[model samples]
Target: MTLRPALATTLALALTVTLAGCIAPAAPTPEPEVSDGLAPFFEQGVDWTECGEGVDCATIVAPLDWEHPAMGSIELAVSRIAATGTARGSLLVNPGGPGGSGFDFVRDSIRYVASADLMEEFDLVGWDPRGVGRSSAVECLDGAAMDELLFGQWDNAYETKAWVTELEAAEAEYAAACARNTGPLLEFVDSGSTARDMNLLRALLGDEKLNYLGFSYGTFFGTMFAELFPERVGRLVLDGALDPSIGALDWFAVQMKGFDDALVAYLAFCVGQGNCPLGGTEAAARSTFTNLLDTVDAKGIESADGRALDSATLGFAIAAALYSEENWPALTSMFEEVAVGESFIAFQFADSYYGRGGTAEYDNNSFDVYTATLCLDDDFQGDEYDVRSGLDAIDAAAPLVGGYFAFDDYAHVEAACTAWPYAPKKQPGMYDAAGADPILVIGTTNDPATPYAWAKSLAGQLESGVLVTFNGEGHTAYGRSNGCIVETVDAYFIDGTVPTSDPNC
Candidate 1:
């Protein structure tokens, strides 16, 4: 029951908003001269055409490898919903994934992802970063092959020699598939390249400075952008901030603890509601979940579609449900069904997390791009022995899921990248946007993906950062049912008011 390397899916639904005010239109500023051999990208124009209800779709061309402009180019899929009233400026939004489809987010889910006022005032802009959905995406195995890869059964005990060998083989196979199908573009899909592409986008959008709302991994992207182009940073809000300084192992360990704590909270709430099968006490709940995992691992139950509900898929289903408290009821139903020898609901939960369609086709390349981007970004260089040595402490801190998460060879980037075709390029370190204006950093106290401490660290690192705390549960803070968090964020974006002190809602 080793965790998959796709923990980013927990924060994949992160949405951001920027408020705009009606101001007299000024003449568009002259495009910045493209230094560093980015002249063609800087001078390109987006041909916007109506693609959906009130949405305009276009493409922006960028060099496939920014470091070598001679190596051809890639098209970035872009979309925008025009402001209903007078426009203030473009409000760039990213639904975090390192892999999430920002273009689809704006074109299909803008109303839910943004405040009505923000939508009205600002032209909501979204684009798929290179190697993400609708862009020059990273292609890997076909749908059926991916299904087998992600949901395949494993019988060996986690951290066992057999498990390590099997998982390593599987990861190597996946990486080879990505390299075979994705080609040289895979080497250039790191966040550093995406950050530079964002600057080109800013210039193309006629913005002298960037006004961005980034969630989860998007926070990492936004932070990278500010560090690279600090003088151009403007009106940036990073919700569910990921601390760029942490390496792969620490990042996974911290998130494992966060999910463990969130599960405890969900269990407590479930028990208080009566008739909860997981039991009344926290210890009882833990025992029940552990037993369930053991049961699934020993003998998988049959799903409605005839797929096996093995421990790995069951663990992924539970982890997916823990992303939001609102999904607790569904989670309880899944557990109840599994208790009664049914596994359809449990499979559905896992499928939703993996973006599997009704016919078993994947909706996008999120998992592929997530793996590619993380392999490029993470700095793990350890083998299976190193992974095993760290498990005791991880299990001590996160008693329930840590064994499954921490010992999984697939979760270890080094295991995957040791045989990967491309070498990782990005170096992990502290980011301080030295000359940036006041930036907003939001953290949910019980955020299951990007932990609260990450937000604190990122805010402190930024030269002029204002921390806005949301004392709540879930993956992200904004656009939840918290009026306090909403009002504070909206006020900052709308009126340019940075809170004098750290405000907790």
Candidate 2:
């Protein structure tokens, strides 16, 4: 294995049973509802009770579908770590998953996600977006069904007629499943709607302005917030930002390239080490990994649990390891095991990436919400010619991982949203928050998920955005061990200091 950059890198019937259920309420607070349409949501108080050490958990109601305020409502799970010192205001944080669990992020991983200075000065708040974990989630397949759909093998290659048909079928089946299980809430999980829900939460929190820190997909949510409620935006920091201006195909292509570049960097690092499993040269390492993928594609390896580790799973495993340099040693061990005909570690990596737990159950509904939100957000052309063109570009840009990423035997981008039932409610385009306060956008030079270019593009797109460059590896930059990056971000959030000019660290 290689290391990256600086060693851091059914019909409506089903809907009845599932959609009728409500999320188990946490402590409830009594607040009077006003006559306004949004009053119930805004005036609703959170009955916070101690959940974990120094963490309070609560749930608030937002309309299941905002468009029809009279319709039913959904409960959003929220968690907060109260400020130790004088609180400036609420610092709403999201870990980025058009599916990630902000509730868990704050409740369990607050120390990793925020700095001591931040924890001391702000009430760190995290909420599961509508149609996500703990929130009124979009229920779909059961664990076994999901395991099969997500991890099972497919029989066609990209650009092939069969491949396109199979992918469209899978997507259609997925959409139907969601529609059957999620009811009216299915269409309301879009980023724009979530941003609206966020605004209501802000009001409920008694904050006139929204202060947010969003990472990865959360950046998209932050962008939508600034665009929708520019005046309400306050101290927004979008790290590993996404460029809303780009279409889905373009975004996927760019991400593939980023992962490819990271792979090469990892290969270089591995070669420098004495006992790299791949080979001595970067090219040699690429060739070795490519060959390994081919081998897996032809005859999938068997995991200790007896599950088959196909090329698609292995590819995902490798990509997951590239997210951070801390995982580099694990990747090396994975490759070592794979070399000896073992694939349990590869499956483990893939499982971790998908948020799977040790008992073979998913920890949350991240994947379900991810697909639902993305389908509702991006417009997919699903044109075969366009798919082939995108595949060509990806393969040319990233030969080592491109095949696995764009067209492996299992899945391809062309098939993703083609058969989705809902039309894109949130169109992909530029965001210009002209009247908002300064927003800080941080980008890592070799970020595999949200490429650095996106940060630059997002910063340029927002009239008041300032780009902060971290010329290093890994996904998000702030609070990940870099003192310079940490200090700059802290100053902005704590002292209201915006970088006079773009700063490259």
Candidate 3:
């Protein structure tokens, strides 16, 4: 809801922290058989050098276009923390942005990435998938342009033709900027291409099969990997799974409802806290939030940096806070300031969501890559009329945040991909991942971004998929949930222990 997973935040921190005191050099993995054209990429040598206190980093080459190998080449940044004990094998992890930096995830937050037992038993590997950070990325507008695109105030009424035209114009300019900046690479950042890249990483790492832990959008990426190479999966754990089979607009509608429900849950908790700034009753708290949005919408609050805090930015601030209950107090604090006409706290949350620095520059190319991959991955169907009709349903389902999710307007369902240059490459469908080893699919009951129903849908779709439910809040379950989830995930990765039944913790 903070766009992607909250863990994917580009908050800069010192990179020298070490999870384990010692590091052991890993024995090189064997190369896998591949066609002559890809042989070089698969057989290329890797030089892992100390990049962090206890982590080694390397850059690998991947084909820019898998269909035509000689088209060009791109670099993939990879990092790993060697197991504290004898390693079972390399366990690849992706922390859920179609654009999240797995390279940063492992290198910076090794302990937060996985449990002690799992890290002790396996070499924890992370990589920036193609079109993400530290890889051959999808660049669009620069910092000032991006800030204007994301936070610039719009005055047109959302449902009007003028609003639709303005939206399309902005996106067209955005798409053109992406094309000008990224060139041919923007067209090929689809999930399918990234899946191929994942397989390449697996072969170069010398792992006979891929052992994966993917969260949120990472689940979609992992599912793509499994579908492409069913027989090559090894103990895949997809937490906060996504159902790629759903259409883009429909998925948006359902996810908005999930976030709305999470907001209600948060309101209930806030009301029970006695001195909650929102209100003493659930209904009162809902009104308090809506009042803040109305107040901000009527007269936008300008931050010291000159960006106006409109309903759109305030809505993102609320959505970002709903990603976890730990962030609930931040939401309360944000409201407390808004109640007094202050914009600083809301800007703090929204800027963090966009990874905007104090200088108004983005820390990473996440938004650019997120847009490219999203538009390229799924075909956003429907015309303006259809989008208007769908908005009715979304608004009906999620009265609180529905308009925000749809840009507070009734434009076409293709909001993000409106003027993108390329059509979607992925045909939404079921992925069985046949013949793969047992795949663990985890779902948190109240996860605002990737809903629990999606996890059930994906698990039911995969042939060897096993569902693990966490009855809790937040976007992901593994490493952050209860002991049952941590132990269940660790046992599967460390000892290949698959639960016979759904451990609905």
> lDDT winner among the candidates?
3
Query: Model 1 reaches what TM-score against the true structure?
Result: 0.92
Residue 190's lDDT in candidate 3: 86
Model 3 spans with C-alpha error above 4 angstroms: 1-3, 6-12, 16-33, 381-390, 408-413
When superposed on Cα atoms, how far off is each prediction in RMSD?
Answer: 4.5, 6.3, 2.9
Clashes of each: 0, 5, 0
lDDT of 2 by residue, 27-117 (tens): 2222343346766776666677677667777788998777778888988999888899999789998888778878877776767657899
Better of 2 and 3 by TM-score: 3
TM-score for each candidate, following the candidate numbering: 0.92, 0.90, 0.94
lDDT by residue (tens digit), candidate 1, 1-505: 1222123223234433332432232233366556657776776666776666677777778999988898989989988988888878888888887788788777767677578878777888989989987899899889888777776665576657787677778878989999999988999999999999888888778888888988888888899999988998978999888888766667777887887888888888878888888877767877898898877766658776667777667776777777778888988888888888788877777777667886669888877887788878764443343445556556666767544544432354446666678877755355888989999999889987788999999899988877889898887777764887777778877788789987799
Kindly provide the TM-score of model 3 when superposed on the true structure, using C-alpha atoms.
Answer: 0.94
lDDT of 3 by residue, 1-505 (tens): 2235445222346665333332343333565457778777877777777776778888889999898889989999999888999987889988877788889887877676478898899889989888887888888888888887787765576556676667777877888889988888998888898888888887777788999988889888899999988988988999998987777666777788888988899889888877778888888889987776666777757888888778767777777777777888877778778877788888887777667887668887877777788888766533343445666767776778755755632232256576778887855356998888889999989988888999999999999999999999988887777899988998998889999999888
